[model samples]
Target: MLVDLHSHTIFSDGRSTHAEMVEAAIAKGIGIYGIADHLCFHDNPWTTRLDQFEEMRSTFANLKANTTSAKILFGMEVDYVRGCENRVLRLKEENHWDYIIGSVHYIGDWNIDSNAADWEGKDVDATYTKYLELLEEMVDTKLYNIVAHLDLPKKYGHFTDIDFTDRYRAIGEKILANNMAFEMNTAGRIKICNEFYPRRDIVELYHQLGVDVTLGSDAHHRNNVGQFFDEAVALLKEVGYSRICYFEEGQKRYLPL
Candidate 1:
């Protein structure tokens, strides 16, 4: 059984529509799929109002109420902005979703994950330190079920000399403490880093910490719905993961791999 729980559509930065995403998931033989679109506070120059949130809720509710396609769930890939947890929480509270994916995309109203120029003239070490700190804080918020793209700081291939073991260990501990799962988001395979979201060592650490595991493609287009999923599954197996998790009606369930 194929499980892909992270994807986007025209709702956010994705390139496909909701119908297109469903068709692509069915085409890929995915038994379980999730439409986890972006939900953030920092405008990034784009703002989603309460009304828009309700509209998104209607789409999710309608999909659940009316879809005859493969098993699908509605979720939001919410960004964790430092010092704005309460505001972000309020924004997310407007909707009753199947699940929530907490991610750290900003450090202080600054988008550091994508666009090479974002890293230009920036201190990679300080940025990474703050990113990890915010990641730990985001998990501490305990407002989300899963953490998306664990190594987002590396999304644009920014690496510093700082040791990641302590930082990742702390982050992993927090995720475990909060009962949040992190997925092997394969979208990184297409990024400059050209690796999974977290890379292998971090996955290994999570397994050692007994953290729950899930999977995603972070697909923005229909064709990429289940892109590189097989590789992610194999990588999980190699890392000692025996089952993958999914959500249904806001409840977490696992399927043996």
Candidate 2:
């Protein structure tokens, strides 16, 4: 079964509507498609407004009631801001989501993935260090079902000479301890990084550490639904992963690769 669990719609930064993305997923032969639009309090254009939350839920409900070709999951990609634990917890309590993808898009109000211009004059090593620190904290919250776009700070080709292998392994171990799944986000391949999120070596490391994974295209447009997934599956199998995971009402389940 082909499952692409992370994607967006007009409710966030995506160009496609929910229905349009579903159609594209069906055409791409996805057996389980999840709509995980952004949920953030950052007041950015990409963040879904608080007022639209109910609409998103209702629309997804309508879709779930009508669509049958593929199993549709209601999800959200929440930004992991340092001082916003209460907000995240409250949102989690209010929504009945199949999965919640925790992403570190910001480091103390500095948007990491917003654009390359924001990266100017930044200390590469410090930035990487901070990103990892936030990731560790996000895992400790024990509030997320999946980690979205691991190593997202590399989105703009910024490099740090410092080796963070040990730190990454610690985080991987924490993720496993928390029973959170790692996400192999394919959107990075289309970005300037020209690679998948977490990188192949990280994927291999996670596999060796016994961290289960799930696939996500991070598609913003309908055409990109399930994009590069074939490559993702091949890479996972090459790394000794014979199966991938999905979620149902927040419970993790596996499928053969």
Put down candidate 2 lDDT per residue, 194-248, tens digits, no spaces: 9999899999999999998999999999999998998999999999999999988
Native-to-model Cα distance after best TM-score fit, residue 171 in candidate 1, in Å? 1.5
Query: Candidate 1: lDDT over CA atoms?
Result: 0.83
Q: What TM-score does structure 2 among the candidates reach?
A: 0.98
Worst 10 residues of 1 by lDDT: 43-52
Write candidate 1's Cα lDDT for 1-257 as tens digits.
88889998877888888888988898888988898888777765333444567678777777777767578788888887766677666765667677888888887868886578878888888988888888888888888889888888887888677888988988888887876788889999999889998889899999999988898999989989888888888889998999988877567799998
- Give RMSD to native, each candidate: 1.7, 0.9
Q: Per-residue error at 55 for model 1, in Å?
A: 2.3
- After TM-score superposition, the amount by which residue 153's alpha carbon in candidate 2 deviates from its true location, in angstroms, is 1.1
The C-alpha stretches of model 2 lying farther than 4 A from their native spots are none
Clashes (N, CA, C under 3 Å) per candidate: 1, 0
Q: Which stretches of candidate 1 lie over 4 Å from their true place?
A: 45-49
